[model samples]
Target: MRPSSILSGLSCAAFAILPCAAITVDLTSEDSIKSAASTIANGMMKFYSGNVTGGIPGLLPGPYYWWEAGAMFGSLIDYWYYTGDTSYNDVTTQALLFQVGDKDNYMPSNQSKSLGNDDQAFWGMAAMSAAELKFPNPPSDQPQWLALAQAVFNSQALRWDPSTCGGGLRWQIFTFNNGYDYKNTISNGAFFNIAARLAAYTGNQTYAEWAEKTFEWTRAVGLMSDDYYFYDGSDDTINCTELNHIQWSYNAGVFLLGAATMWNVTQSDLWRERTLGIWNATHVFFTSQGGQAAGQIMFEVACEPNNNCNVDQLSFKAYLSRWMAASTKVAPWLYDDIKPYLAASAQAAALSCSGGDDGTTCGTRWWNNGVWDGATGVGQQMSALEVIQSNLIDRVQGPVSNSTGGTSQGNPNAGSGGDSNPIAMPAAIETSDRAGAGIVTALILVALVGGAWWMIA
Candidate 1:
């Protein structure tokens, strides 16, 4: 096996055929593997019945919203990618097609509760996942998955309001929401993620510039605090004069993944520093189960105890889970150090499943030690699915060799390791080398042996 084989993988069914030696965690148990994966395709069905059954696939039982559905489908897409089961992929495409409005992008509503910038951004992230992972194409009239994401990027660019905060987007596109004044981290971070990903997939300098602009604006307004902890938004009630320092797991997560994507595109130390700072802040502030910390567990610090997590709030952890897993490539310097925490969370979540022969419901509170404490919902299932999938990403045993290509991009305030400093992208580095081909052309020389159905550590 060659060194490049570790990051290079081809689609088998719908997933990249990763070399098994790269895998770290052991999934020796047949039942654990089944539960972890089936929960994705099956649990998603819990929301609505099909055409004959009289319900939509993406919507919740009631209160249908684009953001939540986008999240559920996002995790499902990842499930197919991780497990290589087309069954997961089929439903994901079907659901996305249902939600994409006549414009070929997501525009579920147009009135007072119409799509917000953040809402649209979630679907954009999913489309990027589809494009980057090489998911199957959609209908001819509809946008290709990559183009679908680009539509969102296009729309968001139009909404980018430079008048207020120099270069940040507002929270809502609809003026009726009374939130137009607020310049938010989620909206900007979401845009940053989409732009950074598109830049990586296409090697477009334009997207990279937008990615950097979004990051700079986000930082300039103090939304992504000097500490790298993301605040709620800029104080629009006072004409953008003040700052609100409320942090959410998803806010930090959106930035982390965006920074990671930027790191992928430019390999800049700024992105690396930003990635490390936000990641470390996320783990430190949003963790622990029960009385003790116990293996770096993650929790929704804002609404875990009182249970104030709204429908939108419920799925925030899912982004954190998936993005943290995706961040493995950006900060490979911390990849080895990060695996145990992912494994610990997944193990706790797996133990949270409780039910009869019918099915199992994964809970929110993972620290209960086999106790299902939180109410089961689509968000809960998404959280469990993402965590399990993260651990399932085996990247350790692949062939190791002396090879390096990225420029020495670093962060000014990278504190976790202490030594990271600022650096610029090298001019000689080839974009082809930075952005590897989306499709690896099979050549799956080393198989994980047991397939996703069953696997060993």
Candidate 2:
């Protein structure tokens, strides 16, 4: 059976048990959102301190936690952008600095590069986030962040093996010792995003060119199928003969975001069209397929075959929501295609929440402790919440449009649509952004702690 068909069947089954409107879109105030963001942030911080960072208060664990860190940092940056909050910047900067301090240690001894695609990607993301914040009005020490990002770019660039696989990144630079082994869509997409973002920030056309080349290489190697679902890049021709066999949310998110960013800088119609296509095709995950929520559409381990639903799935969801929000900002015409999915995702997120003081529950159960691991599941839940929050804002405000005549809602600050309570919208939007940002920052710090704890255990 085609993977899409199989996923459709699974989703139908899951949705049978879930009410269509399980979640209410009543997140009307920024204060409420910010409060929730703060709760999530605190939970994340606790998780990091207890589990990932080896009981350390401020240090990062390593590559294992980098994905969560990068996601959280990205969310925080968005919060800073929306709210003009310097505190978010302060917290994010500190967390990033901690990661940078251990860069050399994380690098492989023999190759002087990152351990795997996740490391390169996450580190690259972290650097890009820092660069975005500091570039135009760089502080005295801001150059360090930009320089470190560039160094990571250089290291990751070296790991690209065009000869081994059809232009895909290796899973690792050293540890696996198999240079021409397995490749995955997430790796290539991530590298593409990192390179593209760096190119835009630096004004160097070379970075943009490299990003496009990597993107093309990914397409050529079968990481991306014609319909937009991704594949696990394995050389095991016997069991995994089809290149587009595996599809994951993160892969889609990374690829779509990368393509969009590249198009933004290069004005490449090819990239823009490809990104829009991927965005539309991947929307299947949010629909009611058969009867389930199509949650499995975001599964990544299909690439590894042995991998199962885990934290990465949650991470993928977070990435997808963020990508959707960001994309809507650039291409409002796509909002209608995206809004319903966001609504459905928000409902699913509400179901994931159980009764708690915070009103959000960790969706997955943790094996280590009969209760949810605060860092892993909690962060995932919060990430989903932020997406829901963003979607709510967009829907109520109406869609803002591009010059081509497609309309989407204007910025929340402009107060164009929605129920315009003079006192309500601004506070709600700002609070939501701040809360989400705070939670995300805390989650990153917590993931670092969780990684350390996991590593030591």
Candidate 3:
């Protein structure tokens, strides 16, 4: 059984009894489509902190909750784009617009005490996504769409300190968390992605410059390894020698899309090289051991087998899946190289969806034995959904055309950087590009499920 089709055959039997008639949840299932994993995660684990930073952990115990919600929301948008379900479209536009809050400032409204540069950057990526996708919005007094992303970008730019590794964004915007002394890859990579997207969307040269500068810094600081492995971050408290060796999926994922976007916009060999480099090297984030092969599996190497990923790390791979699906538009020639891996990974992930007290729960151990790994959460479900969606998205929407920066033929853009229509990569490199949730109390499960072009969600 191809992994991509595992869930397509899934039906109401996979989920708990719904309020309405049990609806099938393949690539269809209109408004009834539900990502209950996301709903439960959002409802139980996330709550508004009232624009401050410190309060209780809302519902979930943690330092950064809103940002997690933001990341999940971003994934939800990807789900929307790939599926084009539109059921979640209003949910996305409505909540995110509100989150942007007075004057489109995510920080003031989000008020996450642990709001690191990476945290805010997540929302920035989402906002850019909405703008590029041309998500409908009500005319508001403040900046609503791309401008909101710009606001976050500008805020980070103001705080960009040259003291560390020549130049980098701080981990935390505030000194409250000791993380302020650190510079992490996700922060810079997310920024790099946002810069590339903005440059592509607005045709702004300044954003492109920022993208190159950010990558150069990552390369210099040893965070972005020569082979494209994205190391965690540098600890200024340790004189920067302490390069936290953790390799998270989101780090590589962002750089993949960033390079893809820049390549599409600038048509430069530099960005093209970056696109291919990250695409090829991203296999390091996963494991190919125990009979699995590198570039054919999708385990979060840092937290698999024994160590389960934390909430933040849980949905990390979704970003990679999201961007890789998008990157195909900037370089259609990569379809042969990219889609199969996603399908195989998606199959492995689908096998992890165990039906139990928590419903149809999924986990992060995609390369484990055929049986489910007993891991469950919104992050897990989201991650599984992301990989599955990537492989089958074309079936529903058809192939995206090369003119719109995609080659899906009839399929719509699943957030492949919006309609500016990325230029197809030259035949030379012919490359390249580019979830879950949960809390401790068992897991939430549902059978049914839940997007766009040009700006993939």
lDDT by residue for model 2 (340-382), tens: 6665555445444432334344343211111222223434554
Q: Which stretches of candidate 3 lie above 4 Å from their native place?
A: 1-64, 101-103, 109-112, 139-142, 237-239, 288-295, 392-457
What lDDT does model 3 reach? 0.59
What TM-score goes with each of the models?
A: 0.76, 0.66, 0.73
Query: For each candidate, C-alpha RMSD in Å?
Result: 16.0, 15.5, 12.5
Clashes of each: 12, 29, 35
lDDT of each: 0.62, 0.49, 0.59
Winner by TM-score between candidate 3 and candidate 1: 1
- Rank candidates, lDDT, best first: 1, 3, 2
Ranking by TM-score: 1, 3, 2
Candidate 1, 1-457: lDDT as tens digits: 0011111112111222311111122355534554566765476456645333676655555454657778777887787667766776767788777776666557665423756788877877787777666566676655567767767777677667755555567888778776777777888889888878767766667778788877776666656656777767764554344565556788877888778777766777877877888877886434565543464777776655444555555667778888887777555665775677777776666665543223366666666545555355677778877887776556322111112222212122221122232112212323332221222222212222122111111
lDDT (0-100) at residue 287 of candidate 1? 56
Q: Is candidate 1 or candidate 2 better by lDDT?
A: 1
> How well is each residue in 227-276 modelled by candidate 3, as lDDT tens digits?
78777777665435546555767788888888888788778787788888
Candidate of highest TM-score: 1
What local lDDT score does residue 410 receive in model 3, on the 0 to 100 scale? 15
